[model samples]
Target: MRAVFVRPGGGGVEVRDVDVPEIGEGEILVRMRVCGIDGTDLEKAFGRPITPPMLGHEVAGEVVESKTSEFRPGDRVFVHHHVFCGRCYYCLHGSYTMCPLFLKTTIEPCGLAEYFRVPRTNVERGAVLKLPDNVGWEEAAFIEPSACVLRAINRAGFRPGDSVSIVGVGPTGAIFIRLLKSFGASVVAAADLSSFRLEAARRLGADIVVNPLEADFPEECRGATDGRGVDIGVLATPTVKPLQTVLDTIRKGGVLLIFGAPEKGEKAEIDFSKLFLRETNIVTSYSTSEVETNLMLSLIASGRVSLRDLITHRFRLEEAEEAFQTARDAGRSLKVVVEA
Candidate 1:
């Protein structure tokens, strides 16, 4: 088996031969077809701690072997890396991601490998989704990420005809724009440093595109919204350095949703006085659950949202290094996929 291994402390990525993992009872082995690469994979590769160490997780593949009768060899599927134990206290309380079982389950050897094992815990907990014949492999690869964005949209209290300002217009931001448009958001403003991303957002339905490097983002949002700012401001970038700018772009009673993920120990200096004076609320949505995954799969299978639009680059499994680097380069790519 061939897999891409990331060494800790920025050691670099290694594409080498390793033993193909043997699945235990009730487990399934997936022969990778394609996998999506995002910032989290980059973090794991360049030396941050991401558990199950081998690292890729937005996977779409075919079943090579399965211990369970429900699935068979040759079945195409999407492996949900995290699964929760329904009987647990966290599950009962609706904190599915917080369940200890959910935090620990993952595909063996990781999604970057040519083949990986799906644990029994994952399969039994609805982590394994069999793809319909109508769904293509590349589109199936998007189930995990789209599920994540769907969860965030649900938590955002988003409504039809509402106004919005997105702080970052990367691949995830594009997904937000597409879904927001479906909900009939009248004003969709996107802010970014990249003209390519901003343009992409526009094609997806952003009415106003602002480059903070060239003009004031808050002022742009206000101008777009008749000086009331936006109804909801989304901080889609990974750093909080833009926290104040995003906060200032929202109406006093609006919500500022932090959707981008930051590294460990990353801190933001926010003014308590300002926050107290304004009634703006801050919220965040973490990893998705089986519930959200079901919806995402249906949305794709039904052709309501096309993940294919986000696919800007594709590389062979052997070109793993270049693929990772391309995904890291914001000026060049949207969604980068590694195909086996």
Candidate 2:
């Protein structure tokens, strides 16, 4: 099997001929059809908090082998990236991503490989979902990221008719725009430094688009919201300054959802006095859970969110480096996928 893997330290990824992962009892082996390249994959390549063997998580594939009776050898499925210990306190409380064991596990030799193994927890607990016939492999790859955005929107307590401003129009941010609009958000404003991303956001259902480099973004969002500021602000960029801008643009009692993962040790200068004076709520969403992934798949199957619109590029497994470069280069992509 061919796989893309990162070196132990901070180094670039390389394509290598590796052995196909062997499934243990209760495990299932998937022959990957497509793997989505994400921001986290970039972080792992540079030796951010994630350990080595990192490559992909958002995967859509067909089952080539399995030891479990619930799934057969020909089922098309989407793998939930994380594995949680059912006995952990976090898992007991339904906060699976917070489980220490979950944080330690790596999906790599992940979905980027020609074939990957699905853990027993993911298989038996319904984390792995069968893709509908209408959903193509490329679109199915978006389930993971869409699920993360869904979780973030839920955490922000987004209500129908809420005014929302999303800072950053990357793949995840675009998904946020679509989901917010589907949920009845009347006013959706998107801010980004790149004109290409801003345009993509508009096509994805943003009511207004603002280029932060060309205008006062926070002020523009406020103006669009009739001076009350947006009801919710989603910080989808890793930059600390954008996060600050999100906090600044939200209404006094508005919610600020930090959905993007910043580099380690990243910090922002926030006004503590203003936070105290105005009842502002700050929340952050990390990864997605099984429940969210299922719901995202359902939404895709229902045509509420079209994953086809998000895909911008596709590469073979051997072209992993080029795929990463395409994703890294702004104005070039909405999402890049590696097909096996």
Candidate 3:
């Protein structure tokens, strides 16, 4: 089997031949069909790499072997990399993503491999979901990410008909637009440094688009919401430099949701006086849990929302380097997928 590995501290990836993962009792082995590349994957590959390099997680595949009765051979499925222990304090408090076990459980050898093993813990915790017959492979690959978006919405306590301003219009940002529109948002305003992404946001149903580099994003967003600023502001990029700008786009007592993951040691400076006086509420959402993933899968299976159009690039497993570069560049591409 072949798997992709990131070169630490260097913006590069290499494909190496490795033994196919072996399944243990109550475990399962899946043959990769398609996997979606994520911004975090690119960040780890290009920027500072974490202890374990990021490869792929938004994945869909065909089951080749199963040791549990919940699934069987020949089932098309989407596997979540992380699953929480429902008995933990975090889980009991509705913060499932913060469960200690969530970070300990993952698919073996990462999701960018030709084959990977699903651990028994994940299997029993409902981390694997069977794909509907009507769902295509590429669309199935969106399950994990769409689940993430849905979780963010839930964590932000997003209300229908609330005005929104998104700070980044990348792939996840586009998902936010689609989901917000479906939930009956009064208006959706998207902002980005890339004109290409702004246009993509427009096509995805953003009522207003602005380039922070070319114009005043806060002013434009405020104007769009009748000079009261937006009800909620979302920071969808990993970089925290634009965080203040996102805060400025929110009205007093509004929520500022951080949806992207920034590297360790990254810090942002803010005026505590204003943050206190304005009563700006800050919230963040990490990875998704089984609860959100199941809902996202059901939404996809029912054809209520379509995510197939977000896929703008596809690369073979051997073309892992090019795929990483394409996503890192963030030009003329929406979502990039690596197919086995």
Top of the candidates by lDDT = 3
Given candidate 3, what's the lDDT at residue 223? Answer: 88
Tens digits of lDDT, candidate 3, 80-107: 9899999989899988988999888888
For each candidate, C-alpha RMSD in Å? 1.5, 1.6, 1.2
Tens digits of per-residue lDDT, candidate 2, 42-122, equal 777763543334679999899989899889999999998676777888899978778887666655468889999887877
Error of 1 at 308 (Å): 1.0
Q: Model 3, residue 120: displacement in angstroms? A: 0.5
Report the number of the highest-TM-score candidate. Answer: 3
- Inter-residue clash pairs, candidate 3: none
The TM-score of predicted model 3 comes to 0.97
lDDT of each: 0.85, 0.84, 0.89
Instruction: Using TM-score, rank the candidates from best to worst.
Output: 3, 1, 2
Any residue pairs clashing in model 2, and if so which? none
